[model samples]
Structure formats: structure tokens, C-alpha cells
Target: MRLRYLLLTLGIVVLGLLSRKTSICSIDFVRMYVGDVLWAMMVYFGCRLLFVSLKKSASFGVALSFSYLIEVSQLYHAPWIDSIRATTLGGLVLGFGFLWSDIACYTVGVTLGFWVDSLPGWGRK
Candidate 1:
């Protein structure tokens, strides 16, 4: 179960870096955060699916919170990491910088996570 979460987190972090780098989309802060949030939600769902024993809502909550933590980590300056984020495809996956709106995104993502998981015959044990 823990491994599932870790893998999902790793995948998301990679994707965030990619998005941050190759984003042809306008860096409209809101849009960026929303995309970030949605991706986080997907990661949450993926994580839950990877490990089936965890409850639906609980997995969503955990994923959302962990996603928030990663967003927060962007505030720190990691030169090598920033370079990597700027260069590699993983950079597009990993996020950069801070945005308060990301919290809203996290909330929406979690909600979406719940909704998706609740789909009949989808994520159930």
C-alpha cells in the first residue's frame, strides 16, 4: 500500500516537472494551479487503485494532502532540482514555485477523486 502511494507520488512529481517546463499554455496562475490540482487528483485515484485495500475517501484525502506538501516544497530553492525540472521531461511533471490557489485545486482534486472512486464497480473492493 505504501509502495503504491510512493509510486503514484513519484509519477506525479515527474509529471509536475514536465508541466512546469513544457507548458505551452499560458501560465495563468489559476489555470496552472487547477491543472496541478486535477493531476494531483488523478494521482490520488491511481494510488488508490494501485493498492485496493485502502478506503476510497481516505486515499483521496491522503493523496490530496501529499500533493499539497509537494506544491509547498516548490518554495524552496533546489538548484540542481530546478535545473532538472527545467530540462528533463520529469521537470514537466514536477511543479515549481508557490501558489495559494493550489489549495483550492487540492480540494477540487480530492472531491473529484471521491466522485471517481464512487463510480459503480470502479474502485470498490
Candidate 2:
């Protein structure tokens, strides 16, 4: 269980990084959406691993809420926050702007996480 979620989280993070670094095959749409979606997925996986007793629905809800909090945080732009956003890691995590589209992406990602967790043997102890 732990190994499965760990690999999934690593894979999603790698894909998210590739989405930002590579512009392959008209995948710019993916470049736009993948980050936020996989961010939620990664969070879901991490949450599941950490809180092993939690239900999938609960984990998904927590991940979605965290994603929304980060998205909403974009509305604030203090100099310190802006400085943090200027860094690649911070920018990727905190984001620079808010978009309604990102909310949809997060929902989709968390839903995917929920579905994936529902698979046989996935959430089993």
C-alpha cells in the first residue's frame, strides 16, 4: 500500500514537472491543466500514505480543500509572497494567478484520486 502510493506520487510529480518543462505535441493544454490536477493527485497520495486509516472520500476532500486554499492564496500579493512566487519551486506550489479553470482541474484530479483509490487492493491494509 505504501509503495503503491509512493510510486504514484513520484510519477505524478514527475509528470507535472514534465508538463512545465516540455512543450510536446500540442500538449500545451496539458501544460496548462496538468500541474494543478497532478498537484491535487500528489497531495491525495501523500495524504493517503500519511493518514492510512482515513477513507478515500475524506482524503480526496482534504486534498481538494488544500488545492483551493493554495489557489485562493494567489489573490494576496505581498512583496514577500511575490518574492516566494518568483522562485520556481514556490511558483509551482503557490501559483501566480487564480483561474476558475484551475478549480475544475483540482476537482478532476481529486476525483481521479478517489477513483484510483477505489480500485481493488488499492486501499487495503
Candidate 3:
């Protein structure tokens, strides 16, 4: 169970890195942040691996909410967090300070993730 989650997170993180390296920011990220898409996919995969009940799809919403939480947190950047954000990985996770527009982006990404999980091969037992 734990390993599955670890791999899910790793895959999402790798996707984030690839997105950055590829400069594929065409996805209206200003209105829907980047990580939420990958995060939603991770949530789907995590629930699948754990054999979670279908009702637990709420967890994907919760994961989507988390990105907003992180963005709001940027409004008050602690020194350590700022330093961590300076790191390439941290920068991707934390982003550049706070931007209210990202809330919408996250919502879109989360919804997209939900649809992805609903695809033919996904979220199956």
C-alpha cells in the first residue's frame, strides 16, 4: 500500500519536472495551477492501489483543495519555506509567492483529474 503511494507521488513529481522542462505551460495554469492536475491523477492512482471505496473520490477534491491551501500559504512566506521554494522542486510545489488566480486553475486541474480517473481503464478494481 505504502509503496504504491510512493510511486504515485514520484510519478506525479516526475510529471511536474517534465512539464517544467518542456515549458508546457499552455494549459491555462494561470487559472488552474499545474500541480493539481498531477496531484489529482496521484489521488486517483492512490485510491486505486489501496482499493478504496468509490465514495473516497472525495479525496481527489481534498487533494485539489490542498494546492489552494499551498497557494494561500504563499501569501505569508516563512523564511524557510521561501528558501525551500528557491529550490527547483520547491519552486514548482510552492510556486512564485501567492496568486489568487491559481485557485481557478487548481479547480480546473482537479476536475480534469477526476475525468481522467473516470476514463475506460481507470479507477477500476
- TM-score, each model? 0.67, 0.91, 0.63
Residue lDDT tens for model 3, 11-67: 876775565543555555522546555654564555555545544367565666676
Residue 59, model 1, lDDT: 79
Per-residue CA lDDT of model 2 for 1-125, tens digit only, reads 88988999999998888877664535778878888788888988988888888877788888999989999999999999999999988998999998999999999998888888888876653
Residue-level lDDT for 112 in candidate 1? 74
Q: Kindly indicate the candidate among 2 and 3 with the higher lDDT.
A: 2
* Order by TM-score, highest first: 2, 1, 3
In model 1, where is the ten-residue run with the lowest total lDDT? 16-25
Clashing pairs in 3: 31-105, 32-105, 32-106, 33-105
lDDT of each: 0.67, 0.86, 0.62
lDDT per residue as tens, model 1, 32-92: 6656665776668676756578787677768877778877777877788788678656444
Error of 1 at 82 (Å): 1.3
Query: Which should have the higher lDDT, number 1 or number 2?
Result: 2
Sorting all predicted structures by lDDT, with the top scorer first, yields: 2, 1, 3
Q: How many clashes would you count in candidate 3?
A: 4
| Candidate that beats the other on TM-score, 1 or 2, i.e. the better one | 2
